[model samples]
Target: MSPPTITENFVDFDIPQAGKPCKTWYTIYGDLGTSKYPPLVVLHGGPGMPCNYLKPYGQLASKSLIPVVLYDSIGCGNSTLLPEKRGDGTFFNIDLHMNELDNLLKGLGIEDEFNLLGHSYGALLGAWYAATRKPQGLRRLILQSGPASLPLWDEAQMDLRYQLPKELQDILDQHEASNTTDSPEYKEVVAEFTRRHVCRIEPAPKELQETFDAAARDPTVVLTMYGDHEFETNGTLRGWSSINELDKINIPTLIMNGRYDTAQDKVMKPFFDRIPRVRWIQFSESSHTAHLEIERERVMEVVIEFLTEDV
Candidate 1:
């Protein structure tokens, strides 16, 4: 049977730091009230990237009978965008995101029974949440292209940079050193790097491209949380590392990444080694955003199998 119609709504969230009410925009697919499969809450990557690219996750709802939820985190996408929050290290922290996520769950009334699928930065957020809170309701975790340690992530990226053509590498280095990341030359190299490690598809999927475009337009959140680019570590989250804490995530976990993923296997090794009940898979033909690229079908199948195995 086909899944129920998707529903889009907004939840009023109180951001204490902003001292104003911010509404989080979320979309739900399938029948939340009646589905036997545990709802999967998909957390999109980027400290600022919205959930638009994750819209395809609704396929699980229609095909596998799983409910799916996607939302734009605070200061991003359809949620409130606080440009003023940018460049202020003290304002954006891990806890701020955690609290917002907690509020989203409570508001959606799914705090008691839900699964989490976090990609990239979202993976870090979800992993940190699971490690620290150990929420009783969180049944499973899907970490896709997740970096276990920011330092290791930077290291891997630098290695990838070295592999690039010397001319492109020089452009990246020169621009970054001069704080001229906005230059077209810098963006050209960034795109080249993305093609190699972000998504290998000839043309990025529409939704994925849209997300990239949005991040390019207003990179405040990503800039504040992460850095000028993938290889840089000058942001507030530069020192963030969840490697030592992965052991605390006792729930069944699935870790995925493309062979050419920006979050290289070396960076994600700690997750496989430390998470007690973890399954690791590398997509040989894909990259960071494999869900929308070459391994799309296989990735979804594996995710559904993992989520439904014990159900």
Candidate 2:
């Protein structure tokens, strides 16, 4: 029950198009700087959401002696906030994140040796990086509730939408059709959907809540990268898919999601079938955020085993 040893800092990241550099906040647990084992770079979901919820993974540093790194990917949390970049879709594309991640790794001097664990959008970013960059040192990868194809995820969400209460569906349809998704009615319906598919917990954990609060305070990146809400992809990231590039990733991979996740089994299946060395596991009782929602210990066990094996 001892507190985790943690170190937090900010690294300067150059955004060429922006013609300047911004600080990307990062935190590390355990002795990654000196450990023989490659550190684990944990990517939080929400091209905009902060990495607060992923804090739970820091326990790995103490329990397994594996260094765990978490960061607020530019524009949210402790990182530089640019409200002016909110509506500029081109400015918040996947490449923006990829570049920032690359810079972060190089700055930490671990670009040559590290494991990647991405959640949701973070996983999408990881897949894109691995398939494209093929970083020489990436030894393993973990995709938690990640979507192989944005279109596939939308289809699954559409299916779930049909099951919502008729009144709720009407509210959603009304707001979406009118381009007034900011309406309270629409938000309420989305919250309902979120409860069932995003995180099943009645009241989300404090850290998770903090991420949401951060997003609310500055939704520029979220709106530009992922639109105003989940279950919908109306931003720059639409049509994104890594399914075709799965074969490019040769490292050991683990695909995980909850049965009730927004990124359901069908959407995740392509990843398992396409990746040469991969394993898939579904948390039946959980939803999107399985690590914090339920089965945290089990997730850690599998993760540590996969990362440490043959290392």
Candidate 3:
């Protein structure tokens, strides 16, 4: 991995959220050759998290001669001040996040046309934009380690959570049942599940750990919708599934995953089968963050192949 060339200053703007307004900060990076390449917009995960961990994702500049924009959504990273916003589960709703994403692109004048790629929760936001708003000039789409439906997400997590040793599962069960979602035991169980399933990167990166450590719970968001544990979904998003809407996305789409990804094998196939113009590819040895886990050259080659197919 080569070091990134810091060339651009941050761009700031405000976008609409459900019932209020939020500010967003974005930056664009490029190689001189990018003058002729397609524009790519990268979306980071965490409905409430920041974009620091994937800062290394800027490496894409080495391969493309085009502009790639990356930004922190309203609440995460370098974005503006979060309100004394009550997490009451309503703060992290996908609809609000999707609106924030759309307004960000439109604010930056990229809404008309651009390649879309999203990771984890960001994937859901991207899909919502592409499907609902159907922004013009939209090119290709990439979904990495994302889920299409909350039910599916919940189901997959349940299966993965039990894979944890019996002792850990018992601790998790006790914490959830006793309404101790903030218990250290619950946090440990979540961390173990994350280490084994999410990134699988040994010596977890500092950026990611910081994000996890400072992660403020919008119990209102996770508890009301995504359930409390790996197998939970308690909010309106409990029915927030997208398998049926896959066909609504008529653009060429790439659905990818890592071999050891927590998203699992069963759930991804449905996205592939249902989306009209879709391709399914998995990194044979990688986990959730394949774009980082796999060699950069190899990942770019695959990305270029798909993005260039009908161009």
Candidate 4:
């Protein structure tokens, strides 16, 4: 079969703080205007990570004839970079991202009808947008490997950390206490944790590696919003929680995670328990990015079935 048609464009986005207009880079797989299904807007993880890692989802356009939209949130990737605003927590809050997503939808003219799928940090953004904005066009929701609350995430991660070897645990504690997360030793330890819970696939996929490189190049957004450490939360989003807001998500939602994901089952349970219409699935052998790991085909099949099934 021929490759799916792909189009790339930048939507002009205005940020009040910048005092000038910025652009949001986005890519579309398949023809949005003529597709029978509502376009699916994908939100990638890492407030700073780009959409490159989630590019695999583009397959939906060819497999299910569903238009797929992927965009880099402001302050990250092919979009506008705000290195000057680094360490400014107020400038890189979740509200900015929500507005960016809203602007991208309107900019694309698909705000009137679309399906939403967000992975990791993107899931948190998607849930907040759906619950608060209640965009009339949003038809379905998918929250993949995302935490329901920052407090819960921290607690779960700490539990996982304690399970690691004593020497590794001591190294993490020493580095965190010294505020030396930038050290190569600390980063290597974090990478070890990531391999076990984030992506178990050895020699990470090229797309996923691109995301890592992007984050390493300019960690402004992640540093301000998420923090220097992966398992800890000492950034702008430290106290954020969406447990109460889940009830507002009235649309059908799918929540999935890996049995070994950093987003533990407890972290994702609130969505399944609170969202009025929701289903949960767990990939036994996968980690955080199940779609790119062992269950790629199964992940695609489950998502297609969820998106296409009647309400």
On residues 201-295, what C-alpha lDDT tens digit does candidate 1 reach at each position?
87888898888888877888888988766586788989789988889999999999999988999888999999999999899999898888877
Candidate 4 on 69-106: residue-level lDDT in tens?
A: 99998888999898999889878888888888889999
TM-scores, one per candidate: 0.96, 0.95, 0.85, 0.97
Candidate 3: stretches off by over 4 Å: 1-21, 31-34, 88-92, 217-230, 294-297
Colliding residue pairs in candidate 1: none
- Considering every candidate listed, which one attains the maximal lDDT? 4
- In candidate 3, position 286 carries an lDDT of 72
Candidate 1 TM-score, true structure as reference: 0.96
Candidate 3 similarity to native, TM-score: 0.85
Candidate 4 TM-score to native: 0.97
- Of candidate 2, the 10-residue stretch with the lowest lDDT total is 223-232
Q: Give me the candidate number with maximum TM-score.
A: 4
RMSD (Cα, Å) of model 3: 3.2
Runs in model 1 lying further than 4 Å from the true structure: 1-4
Model 2: runs farther than 4 Å from truth? 178-180
